[model samples]
Target: MKKQRYALIIIDMQNDFVLPDSPACVAGALATVAQIQKILETCRRIKWPVIHVIREYRADGSDIEITRLPEFREKKYCVPGTAGCEIVAALKPASDEYIIVKKRFSAFMNTELDIILRRLEIENIVICGTQYPHCIRATVYDGVSYGYNVTLITDATAAQTPEIASANTRDIRDIGVECVSTFYFVNNIAVH
Candidate 1:
């Protein structure tokens, strides 16, 4: 069998979501940085396409979701030109890598992600990064809906709590998405 063409997508690993002191921090996000970094390194070594998907909003909250607007006005995050909107330093995209900025939970929503993936002829996507229930879940489901094989690197992804992560993982797996740890994914890639 031929090795499937795929891309590694690192989603929402930004200061606002991953830093412990950031206003929008996800409790478990900080811990997954290292795991995400590991996967990033492996992908870079293997010369795989790496796409960094990030969330960004206008400082005035003009582009923020209507449901999040009230809170966002008070506690702003992921604002453009701000450090909080940047991808965490540890997993910064290389000069040749792609960065997709999204204003919604799903990276594919109104973004050029699908176009880029299609242009690359990518059939599978290995996803990782912060907060499972929202961004991760949305992106994974959308990937499936778009007819792409999706793999969620469980350890490289995070949620506010382990319980939340576990629950989301089960739900994601039930959809036939491959959910594996960073180690397992890296090893499996090696074997192929």
Candidate 2:
């Protein structure tokens, strides 16, 4: 595929999901962070658009979707006022980066992510982050639905186990998103 103006939409990279010690943190979350850092560094060097999509719930949980699962529904994980809502320091966003705090699985749902991407004229999206079955999958579908050429950096996203991760990755590919590895993406970008 030809390179276009792409936005790196990192989904749910907040402390609650990314830090290994976080209450609701998925196992192997820290490893995903390391992969994200590598992508972030390359994006910075290449001057690509980098957007961090966080899930910041309301303090009273009034704004949350009660229809979702209990793990995500009733629990107030990334409450807006709490530190768990903040992006991890390892992948701290720079001044030029875009930060979008969303309330749902799809980053474009009731969020500024779509507006930001449009303003940047970004037609391609390179998606990478935690929990492949959840936010990652949701964001990829939304990216495609919203008319962005979406690609999932397979090695840059992870869940609790390799089996689940592989299955999730396969599901994403079946939906028509190009699922490529981090090494393939970064190496090409480095030499480009």
Candidate 3:
């Protein structure tokens, strides 16, 4: 595949999801942020499209339905325009990069991600994000549905458990997506 025609999507690498004290933080999520940054730097240097997706909820807890999770609704997390919803400092995106705000686990749901990718003429996607089973996996499926060659960067993503990660990786590959390590993907691109 042509690496130049691909984009790097960094999903939900936010404070509330990576920080230990945050309400919805995942374990070791922060560990992969540096790796993700390195990927972003390389992509930027090569002028590849970079898209960052973030989850945002309403502060008053009004946008979030308590019925979805009675316990979670009470917690103030990822409120729209809040600090917790902001992406981590280490992966500061450039001004020209695309920033996608998604309300649900699927980044393409009710979002212009598909349209943007189409506009960019992107045929393949390199996904690197947090919460593998949730947003990252969902996005990968969506990418395939949109006719993009999707590659999951395992080292740049994290989940609640190893089992979940392994299962998601297997599932994604089962559907024709390529699950690869960040280093391997980068090396292949370099060789290409």
Candidate 4:
């Protein structure tokens, strides 16, 4: 087997999602910024790939998921060419890092993420992002289903409420997916 390479997959930490008082907000999202940024710094230090998975939609909302299409048509959370679509300032992608735009919850759904990861020869994916029950969970499940070693950084992800976040992380842990805290991952995985 080939050597196992890894990448840091940051999902949907755009202005619309993480910034406080945005049109739509996940209350716990903003709290994760510091941890995510710290992990990004480690990835940069190690020269590991950082794949930023964002969400962008057309003005007419043609590309949005059905569940979110109404909101998109009305408010346009992450429309292309808009400030909302851009990644949060604190966790900005460097010139060398990659950005993957997806219209759905899962970064892998209808996106080139798999192809890019394959091309980069990434075998282990460490994920951290907003809204634990939705985007983070979906991406983690998809990564595991695709046979990649998936790790979810619990402290680096959040949901609208502490209860929701706890439930989601418990469910995620109940599954076979590896779940770790930001401190544990940074201490143990950064050198690999």
Candidate 5:
């Protein structure tokens, strides 16, 4: 079988999740910025599709789930036209790159992500970004359900703590996803 085309899916690396001063900030989210940037540069050099998945909720909280509605309203996270919703400075998508706005954890949830990926003829999804337990894991599960090969860039995806990141990586790997560090992916790009 031939190696399938890959698209780098950077999930929820938005200002609200990554910046320390933002209300929805995950404790270690910003740590993965450089790693994401590194892998993204490699993807650009190789002409791979880069899809940036972001979370943007309505100010009225109608777009969010019942469980998260209260916190989202209180935190005012990722509201439209707000700085919190913007992609963080270092990892902003290029004008031509695909930027998918999602209301839920999985990028495929109520979004055109699957359609876009299909149109681009992508099979292997190289995923990296914030809060491994939620967004990253959800997207990975959906990617598998959609029958695409999934590679989790472990070091480039952060959680609240190192242990949390490690445990989630292990769980995702146990399910047959390729779990690797940003360095591993970058160094092996020549073969990819």
Candidate 6:
């Protein structure tokens, strides 16, 4: 059998989204930090490629989406040179890991994520990170659409509420993406 090439894509784990006190905080995001850390450690140990996908918007809101423009302009977050735009310290990328800056929800949308994965010859993508309804869901869908075997670490990905997380997990699973816990993934999938 041909070996399965895997990569870990961590989406939108920036201070703006993961910090509880931040303006753009996702309620459940802070809780997933330890779980995401576990996954990150495992990936680093196993020598799998790790990609941190962060969201950034122009301070002027000129590049933000139409629906979000008003809010973004009123309360700026994820702008360059701001602490909120940086990836959370615990999950910061190592020197060799990849960091992708995305302006939109989906990491693959207008980003170098797809091409980087292709260049790495990655066939299986393990995804984790915040806000299930938007960034996480969109990236998972696009990962599948891009013809990669996508796996979601349920405990490591977050949404504003448990209901939203569960609902999105169900929808993602319905599309045939593997949804498993951090423990399960590290013990089973990542081992091989």
**TM-score for each model:** 0.97, 0.90, 0.92, 0.96, 0.96, 0.98
**What is the per-residue lDDT of model 1 for residues 28-144, given as tens digits with 9 covering 90 to 100?**
998998998888888888888999999989889999999999989989999989998888888888999999999999999999999999999999999999879999999999999
lDDT of the structure predicted as candidate 3 = 0.84
Q: Encode model 3's per-residue lDDT on 1-192: one tens digit a residue.
A: 644478889999999899888988888588899889878988988789899998777665555544545646656778767778888899978999999998778889999999999899888889988988888988999888878888888888998888888888899889988888878877885234
Highest lDDT: which candidate?
Answer: 6
lDDT of 2 by residue, 1-192 (tens): 755677787877778887767866878677877778888899898889899888877666677767544666545688887888888889989998888888777888888888888898888899988878778888888888999988898878868889999998888898888888778889874344
Q: How displaced is residue 144 in candidate 2, in Å? A: 0.9
**Sliding window of 10 residues with minimal summed lDDT for model 4:** 69-78
Task: Tell how far residue 77 is off in model 3, in angstroms.
Answer: 1.2
Instruction: State each model's C-alpha RMSD to the native.
Output: 1.1, 2.4, 2.1, 1.2, 1.2, 0.7
User: What TM-score would you give candidate 5 relative to the actual structure?
Assistant: 0.96
After superposition, the stretches of candidate 3 with alpha carbons farther than 4 Å from their true spots are 1-4, 65-68, 190-192
Q: What are the per-residue Cα lDDT tens digits for candidate 6 across 96-182? A: 999999888899999999999999999999999988999999999999999999999999999999999999999999999999999
Error of 5 at 73 (Å): 2.4
Alpha-carbon error at 91 in model 6, in Å?
A: 0.7
Error of 4 at 154 (Å): 0.7
Cα miss at 130, model 1 (Å)? 1.2
Better of 2 and 4 by lDDT: 4
Give the residue spans of candidate 4 off by over 4 A. Answer: none
lDDT per model, in order?
Answer: 0.91, 0.82, 0.84, 0.89, 0.90, 0.94
Model 4: per-residue lDDT, tens digit, 67-180? 887776667688778887789999989999999988788999999999999999999999999878899999998998998998999889979998998888888878788889
**Clashing residue pairs in candidate 5 (N, C-alpha, C atoms within 3 angstroms):** none
- Cα lDDT of candidate 2 equals 0.82
Cα deviation at 115, candidate 6, in Å, is 0.8
